[model samples]
Target: MRFGMGQQRITRAECAHVAALARLELTDEELDRFTGQLDELLDHVAEVEALDLEALPPTMHALPIANLLRPDTPGEVLDRDEVLAQAPFAEDGQFRVPPVLGEAP
Candidate 1:
């Protein structure tokens, strides 16, 4: 299907080729549907490209952004013994977890 007045059109064969490269198995109906959808998307892109955006400043986001992180400051450290006592399993003054990779402890 054609896109807008002079925009390029997406063909079913091209869509099929893309699907093959992506290891997709689309039916004939799906190919037709996707081709039309892609054509519409390209038309929208063309319209956007035709807009007068020279005066507008380029921006990553629509709204103003600011860092929300708090200041990093030194904090009180917890006692190792107290923290180990709260754990379900502790060994040699450390928290003990089950073997993950079948390695001998």
Candidate 2:
């Protein structure tokens, strides 16, 4: 029965109705729990709505961001034998990996 000014409180019966509409079966305890949870969510929404955010600029992120990418440049490749020597497993001049699609019979 508690609600802030202009805040419409959600009732247990309304919660039951919504559950029925969604084809959800809930026990009395679950219905009671959800009714309280829904009220808290609605109260939070109302609190946010009361805030004056029009003076602030809209932004996708909190801080300024810029691309830090560097131009791609060609570099000398490592010798295949040298690279493969560091690998735990290799076959036919390539890194060997476990079968991912399926296991061999």
Candidate 3:
């Protein structure tokens, strides 16, 4: 089996186990894909382990971030009729979208 150093080739059995734990139902193809994806992810983690950070003092953070400014003032808005005119199907001053929630029969 082709393998990356320190990376365990995730097996179908492990995929199935994980799918069960996650309450996911996967077909054989999906299981195989998940195994490969997990193996690649572990390989990346193994590479990260090789990083050298011994010289630098443990800095808890890189930079502090402040809240971005946003304006609360009302700005010019699109006219409802103008906006609704662009839709292929609009109902009563609103854009019509495909029903996701069940509609009354």
Candidate 4:
């Protein structure tokens, strides 16, 4: 699903049509580029169409992973009063910031 699905050999004319639909005016170099690209893409599609999918189990995740955990521990807290003392504007127990906007018209 992430890659190729259907099988179809791409042609230069189809590349031209796609370029026209995308509003692209391709030069000879660009047209050749797109032609090769489309051909390769279709070749990939043909490859995917040849897959044998009779035994693979479909799953939500690719593989299982585990994590080791440790118990929570309290740590030393910052001195709020000391921090606020260095603030440009501090009121009551919290640091005050400037208003973003003036009164609306």
Candidate 5:
């Protein structure tokens, strides 16, 4: 399944060759199915490459947008005693979460 800028050759024989290399024994029906899927995928890629995207600037988002956010500011926090009192489990000055590894308690 070699794909690059040049061209895409996703024939049944090619798919079969790749499958054999991977020690996979695919049935003829599966090979044909994968070959057609690969060809369709390559055709889509070719279509995308044929588009005139050069006129447009590269952008992470498709639309013009900005993060509408408030400025970070210092604020009052929950009291330690009050917060700890609501915890299902707590030890000393921290919440007692279950063990991350080993057998479950």
Candidate 6:
């Protein structure tokens, strides 16, 4: 099977081969469904390739973008003792979090 001029259609055998390579065990119904879906995707790609895109400028994004973050500048640091006082569990001037690796605190 072929799509658009010379774009070879994705075959069930090829799809099965790819699935085997990826260690997948696909059923006949899945192969058929995926082959049809991949063929449709390839057809769309071929259609895009057939377009004359030389006149259009390439873009990384479809719409214009700008950084919305505030400018990074030195800010007042929170007092360590004050912040630690608010924690439910604070020890040795730092927040005390539960052990993660099953190690004793």
Local accuracy by lDDT, each model: 0.85, 0.87, 0.81, 0.78, 0.81, 0.85
What lDDT does candidate 3 reach at residue 33? 88
Model 1 per-residue lDDT tens digits across residues 30-55? 98898888878878877798899999
Return the TM-score for candidate 1, rounded to 2 decimals.
0.67
lDDT of 5: 0.81
Tens-place lDDT digits, model 4, residues 23-81: 99999889988898887877776677689967988776788656657668988988999
Best by lDDT: 2
Per-candidate clash tally: 0, 0, 0, 0, 0, 0
lDDT of 5 by residue, 38-98 (tens): 7788878777877998889889888878777977998999899889999987889899887
Which sections of candidate 1 miss by over 4 Å? 1-8, 74-80, 89-105
Clash count, candidate 3: 0
Of 2 and 5, the candidate ahead on lDDT is 2
Give lDDT tens digits, candidate 3, residues 12-71: 798799999999999999998888889888788666777897996876568765667886
- Candidate scoring better on TM-score of 2 and 5: 2
Error of 5 at 72 (Å): 1.9
Model 1 is weakest, by summed lDDT over 10 consecutive residues, at 1-10
User: TM-score for each prediction?
Assistant: 0.67, 0.60, 0.49, 0.61, 0.59, 0.67
RMSD of each: 3.7, 4.8, 8.9, 5.8, 5.7, 3.9
- Give the Cα error of residue 84 in candidate 2, in Å: 3.8
The residue-by-residue lDDT of candidate 2 on 6-104, one tens digit each, is: 565898999999999999999999999999888888888777988999999999989998988987998899999999999987899999876898654
Candidate 3 TM-score over all chains jointly: 0.49
The local lDDT score (0 to 100) that residue 34 gets in candidate 5 is: 86
